[model samples]
Target: MSINRQIVLASRPQGEPSADNFRLVESPLAPPEQLADGQVLVRHHFLSLDPYMRGRMSEGKSYAQPQPLNEVMIGGTVGEVIASRHPQYAVGDKVVGMGGWQEYAVVNAAQPGLLRKVDTTHIPLSAYLGAVGMPGVTAWYGLMKICEPRAGGTISVSAASGAVGSAVGQLAKSRGCRVVGFAGGPDKCRYVVEELGFDACIDYRQHATLDSLQAALREAAPQGIDGHFENVGGMVLDAVLLQMNAFGRIAVCGMIAGYNGEPIPLRHPQMILTSRLRVEGFIVSEHMEVWPEALKELGTLVATGRLKYRESVAQGLASAPEAFIGLLKGRNFGKQLVKLI
Candidate 1:
């Protein structure tokens, strides 16, 4: 209890990420002797593992700044406030914030929008980091604001069984649109359609080649795709482009397939021009203004059991590296998380 455990990036990855890139270290759980005003100490219980973290590990031009090496890996954490010298926060309050990959954090309550208490009455505590947190917000903003679903229209989502994609499909369905998803395997495809209420689910692995993927997508989405919420950008994007309806809209949330390999190129860049498609890529963090409204709606859905989600949890902090590596390979199902408590 007196030592703070951390999972820090030991080295940048080459190709697919591995456990050897992360190093675990321990530091004394020490607080400042003279507490600054508005200071609070947090003990992290859960940490979110996401695909974006892969980008942070590499020193490359990205939408977000690279995470510093030899420091606790940057991530979202939900924890309890154990000590507070601030007016707003109090001991025992459950809060969600970016406390990184550490067991403890000392943050100033006056820090603008860094930490906030979460309501755990109707929603599960861990759900704050998954369904109603950043991922949920990402889904909401991308699907509603960017994709702009049309009722009775067809929407195709890639990485359909994971955190952001699952929310996107369900949300689109709620708008009276027919939603289809591209997941990795039969099991995930089944879950996307049967459990998450998607109209059709395509197993991308079953159709690895671009031609096969295009055929499968065409078969699944007979009407052509009106909107796309893309997660895996390699073959999935290519296939979707071929099936795109005129004036189709694409909300490019992530290109995870290229995270560990050579950058994926669009097989048909001309489709955007010929078909008059609207394609927009976004980083969720850059748009914080929409979060309040987005989280409110997403939270209500998850709490009422209308929005469904699943989590793949690793037991401890030490497991984050391996869990993260598996995430890049599409090994974990649903939302990947690490439980430090």
Candidate 2:
């Protein structure tokens, strides 16, 4: 453990990122005895690969600062404390924090919200990076707080098989709403309907045009969509707009279609005025107060087996770049993680 291995941002991407944008680097690790008073050494077990990280890689203006070149790529990590010079942390403590793309990290445990101890008795340590973590909280806040669906109403979700979208559908179903999902292919569509228990799942690829997608949505959501959770934009959003009921609420989570710098101009901007839709975009990190409440429900659902989740895991830290690229292309099923242990 004398050397720490990491994936650093080598260059900013122009559109789609390739392996050239990332570089693997190694650095000498200071011994436990040489650590500063408030610092702790952590050995990362798992690293999370999220879509939002793509936004951070660019130098453009964003909600958060862009990832600095030649630094460890920004990410969420769950690990074990190997050495501690802090009062609250001790060796073997299971914790979660922003440990980035490195196999090991030395961070100040004294910094509030930087590190947190988690219980693995009910939920696995890896779940701290997924369902019972940020993605789950993002789902809860967007669905419950923004797109409030009433019982017997219909809810439409895009990117239905993804980590956040899956949770949004399941949580909405629990509240007695008829949930319909929109996914890329037949296999993903089947999983969304049969496995995740959505009322129906539309294979968006089959309906390549806005009019075609709108026709399919009409059948799945016969009563019209009362609430919508959008993940993919472009044609999908346009179709959802056409089917939305009057005064329907929409929670805009992601626009992965435009992440590669493609222009996603809405075909029908006037639909918002005609439908009286309330569409709001949110960044989950900005609302910290709701996390505790969100995590409590998400943790219980996951622990009790009511909330089912999936993960596509890569073998080592070196595989992160490929795994992340695969995620953007929808090659990975469910939550994507890189195992560093």
Candidate 3:
């Protein structure tokens, strides 16, 4: 008897997505008889708005395919099960999965890589969509596996106050590596260093050029960067490459700086060969097997006051468009979420 409100793609975005690209429509809820055996009906509570979703708005193929036109925009969400024909999940159980930008969905329990029941007793259900979710796992596996920083070494991270970036800096610090972070403004830089416990943080907005960034980094870590967690590509990455020590490792998590179709030329290819640096680009979904272990470790760290997280939450689904626009514009302080009833 319930009807669902959903956000569907009205048109493919040429560059950054605007409110006009999304069309909110109403659809009749799936009938109980249509529910497959071991399927459940879920009402969405929290929706994740990520930078990667911007790539999905375009038609080009990358790590994941673009969302088809008129289809619901795909995203990770936390929801409450309203009706369950499945033995594993009961009514009122909270779960996290790819629920898209919709109010309700019928999910098949037997579907491979579907929803996972969350234990909300220890952490808030929203954490599953942020810290303990894909972003956390992305930070953990990318840094530990790709850029293995040794004790007494130095690691540098861009967008260091962001969800994944913040996690990377803290994890490196915990491992005894000196951490340096790069954020947009003075406030975020201060938060990264003072609140997030980073060894040092540079305000990229204040720096006029790559030379200034280099000078700042040199002062922060006299030994030079042994490992780099790259979230923003372009001149910043080029500058970092110039300061890397021999045999440095780079984990390429994202290219937020050039996400809006900016022209960013590769200026320092010689660093990879001359410095013997290993630069690897990774998609977090490829390392799904390690998620449980990462979650356990990160959960313990957060619960024990070792790991810290911050979220910038939008009040409702109607605010999702603005929140997403802000996220792309670097307006969000941390992980951005849309809280929907």
List model 1 lDDT by residue over 12-94, tens digit each.
98888889989999998776454578988899999999999998888889888888888899999999998889888889999
lDDT by residue (tens digit), candidate 2, 94-201: 999999999999989999999999999999999988889999999999999889978999999999999999999999999999999999899899899889899999
lDDT against the true structure, each candidate: 0.91, 0.94, 0.89
lDDT of 2 at 339: 95
- Candidate 2 vs candidate 3: the TM-score winner is 2
TM-score of each: 0.98, 0.99, 0.97
Q: Which candidate is the best by TM-score?
A: 2
Ten-residue stretch with the least lDDT total in model 1: 28-37
Candidate 2 stretches greater than 4 Å from native: none
Residue 1 Cα positional deviation in candidate 3, in Å, after optimal superposition: 6.6
Off by over 4 Å in 3: 31-34
Candidate ranking under lDDT, highest first, comes to 2, 1, 3
lDDT of 2 at 300: 99
What's the CA error at residue 229 for candidate 3, in Å? 0.8
Distance from true location, Cα of 72 in model 1, Å = 0.9
